[model samples]
Target: VAGLPNNFVFAQTGTYTFTMVTDPNNQFAECNENNNTLVRHITVTNLPDMRILSQHIAPSKLNPEPGEPITMNVSYENIGQSNINQQMKLKLLIDNIPVDSVYPVNGLVTGGTTTVAIPASWSSSLVGIHVIRAIIDADDVVNEGNETNNEATRSFVVGSSANLFFNQFFASNNIPAPGDTIILTARIGNNGDLATEADVSFYYLNDQLDTLLIGTSAIAVPANDSITLTFPWKVINNSTVLAARITNASELEFTYDDNRATTLIGGPPQVTVVSAAACTGTDGGSMTAVVTGGKPPYTFSWSNNASSQTVNGAAGSYSVTVTDILNRTATASGVIADSNCCPPCTKAPKKPSLLISGMSSTGATNKFCPGDTIIVSVKIPDPTACSYSWTVPPGTVLLGGQGTDSIVLALDGNFAATSNIYASAINTCGTSAIGTGKLNRGAKPGTPGSITGIQDGLCDVSGVTYVIPTIGGLVYNWYFDTVNTATGAGIITSGQGTGMVTADFTSAWVKGVIHVTASNACGTSGARKMTNLKPAPGKPAGITGPSQVTAYQAGVQYSI
Candidate 1:
């Protein structure tokens, strides 16, 4: 091989060595003996080479959502054997016109080149199609034999960033309960040239109108696409008015013009305590109240002229009022209203509401073991039509009375029994809440003692029977085998008693085996084996004395 000529204006060319080898018989005697007769030739050609030297963008093109930071990718490639050293620069261009800014490029390439990032300001004006070009220059190479100053240019279009937009914004209720999570979803759209990252935030207003940041999240929106972003805001006990906002952090700066949106926050509806049976009483009674419409955070107070009764603070079906705040004023009454509002302005109940006070059971402990019977009974108002239903825990079966207020359950394995009681006032409009009782069965012991005394019989033995020993509180299962022709196999037998079980085979046989198993509440015992049975009796034979045998032989000898 030979190197091509470097500076030829016309077609550049280079020379290559050729070799010839020849047989000794065909060569002339005077010719050199060391030279070969075979001939081969090679040639080299020179051609001008051009390749991308370097590329870049003015502003670094990166993961910018939309209309944020302008993104550009600069690249370079080896054009000639000479090493290229230069300061590369990138510019954003629209319709062949240079954009406002320029990004400087810096790196070295010996043989191959690489791409680099260029940062620039994103432009909202360049909406549809825009091009960016990277210009690279050697700037210093001037020697004759050295490679000429090289320049590389690459063009690309800028894509629109992602944008968020919504049709409408609203909140279900402004006032949320403490520890409650509120989910707010916003319908968003991608309006920019490229996809953008959307962020949703929830804010709450303090008494000073200052917004307290509640939550924020990053959401993905495709270019020219729309999606909904859901954000959950946790409610604190002291929270009052809560609001929400959505933004798209694309390009570099946040875009609020076409994508940003907000919603109005409100409080929970007001709850009114219509009337409770008696806030203070000797025996526990029900408290009845009507929940009025208002924002949440409503407070309730009851008066019964006694000091021992108290009440639950939140809104619910029942509040345990153990103390009476209002002393004896000749009249006992209670007031309920929004906690933030003053008295009288809040709605209060006029009369006491009827409520079932107590329901309980005493027959069985809450838990039981498998196969153990449990009796469950509950106490409710005497005149009410009360019904009971039993729910068995997983891996258990209820023998009977599946849907009854009170029932007996047999525990099996690790299972529990649950009873739900439903009561209705004889003529009341609403039914009372269900009361539940649970019975748990602990772990079960290992299998009980094994069966014993199994026996085998011979072929032609029509049947074989064995009595199972009596085992108190233990169950027994019997298995037997009979011989057919030559082989013996196990057969399940009927009429197997629990305590004393007897197994019978259909055909009598020699060499048969019987297995008996005993079981108890804990578990089953190992089986016992019996082998080898006596053959059945056939015809009977008679025996004679020695003197009778001799006389009979002498009398028979003369005739025979």
Candidate 2:
């Protein structure tokens, strides 16, 4: 009652003053003080001191383009002896020339700071450096004590600014062979007085101008200087165009037209290739090529110098290079397996792909619960010729489909474990790479922590609060007399499906209990019971005052 306002009643009075309180030894503490009264004083200055504390221009920029609307925010303060309540005029000036001569200002409280705005936007024009000024009380409206600090000024430029563009593109091999290493150079230049940081993007393009951005390099372009960026590039086909550009130029840039340029490289002519594998009882193997496009009458050079349309070799890999009449060359290679690779002309199975639950399963994911059945499958080139074998995590049971490309597994419910389920595709020729899926044991929410609240709640009391340690993603349900006693407690008023609850107890409740359970998509946890709960006996009836005693009498006795 000492510090609480509007509470005038006091049981006993000696002296009191307020002090902050904290838990001492976490158990017991009391507040005490000893003063009969307190006093305070108030004072203020009478003269007002007005000044423009600070001002800022919105869309702050070095060189805002002509006709770009910009606003100014001016902060005026009354650091004075008295508060002003009447309207005052603030002025906005460009180059000390008032554009807005009478922008109105609402008054400020004593020692208070406030912001005001002009009703018009100022467009930066007339390309040159200019001054922006915010002057408060320029006409002596407030009769302020100090008049020197009524204005603030800032400077901005509308003239020369940072301008970067592509100067020229150069390459060591403009007429380069396909797949030849070409030294590419992109020259970036700046024409203004401001330096800028930019990125030079290089792209590989076809005659159709279809582009592939290969890479970019960070460059610092000095004002009035040119810098060359170099990168190693290769042409993929004839008429390949190499392009370079300056990306993310500063807003102060004059124009963007010259920021990018392209140069075309003439790629050399080439040929296509095809080869045959060795057969059981024929020439071991052969490589073949013919000029399809470009100059005809193509010539072939095999690794063994068997220069012709076709070359024969033993069971192995062979390299083939071809040159057209213009001597522009192309390279390729082929493999010739042993003549006995297959009796029926077939290849062994390739690596098989596996999935769980019809898709790739991330390792040890909790999305699947224990006792859940999962489908495991594999895909191979020729499923009809391949048989699969499966292995699962320990304690899991394989249901069926082990010899085929798919299998079913029953997750072990008795234990939660993380492991992979693997399968292999087998053919008469060879076995394929092992395909794998994974599983993690998921289950119902664990039993919740103890319920906490007043152990012996009063009978017939309403809105008593109880709470349990919260488990995220679990729904909690609370009930009274869940053990089925006649009147163990009363109704749960609110906070169902949450970690806390409030309830109203029955007047006759005794030896009651609070029961709570946590549940989720998996299942419900066992009930957590708060036992040994009983209401304190209703308070004893109040004593009655007897016949009234005379007023203004001292020591008069009354009987109960």
Best by TM-score: 2
Across residues 1-560, which tens digit of lDDT does each residue of candidate 1 receive? 12122222322234555454446476467556655545545434321122333233333532233365555555655443333433334333545555443334443443566665544444553443344444443332212112342434333234444445675555544555666777766676666566767577777665444678877878777777777666676665333444555564655322344444565444233333343232221122334434333322223444432222244222223432221111111222343232221112122212112221211111133434455655554443323222233345564555543323334555566543443322222112223444454444332222334344334333333223455556444456665553532343333333343534433333444455566666545455676655553344433455433433554355432211
- What TM-score, to 2 decimals, does candidate 1 have? 0.21
Worst 10 residues of 1 by lDDT: 322-331
Candidate 1 deviant stretches above 4 angstroms = 1-369, 373-463, 481-492, 500-510, 534-560
lDDT of 2 by residue, 1-560 (tens): 12321233322212444443444344544454323234433222234677764333332454566767766666778887454545678888888887785546666777787766666667766876677888877766554556688887766667677778887797888777778888888788898778888888888764344688868888988889988889887667544557888888653565555788887666445555566776432344666764554333456777866677777755567777876544567887776665543333255565667766721121134456555667877644344234566787876688766556677777555434567877666666666677777665555677789998876756778878899998655678797774434554576655667788887787777776788998754568888998877788534566566456677867754443
Question: Residue 22 in model 1: shift from native, Å?
Answer: 99
What shift in Å separates residue 439 of candidate 1 from its native position after superposition? Answer: 13
Q: Who wins the lDDT comparison?
A: 2
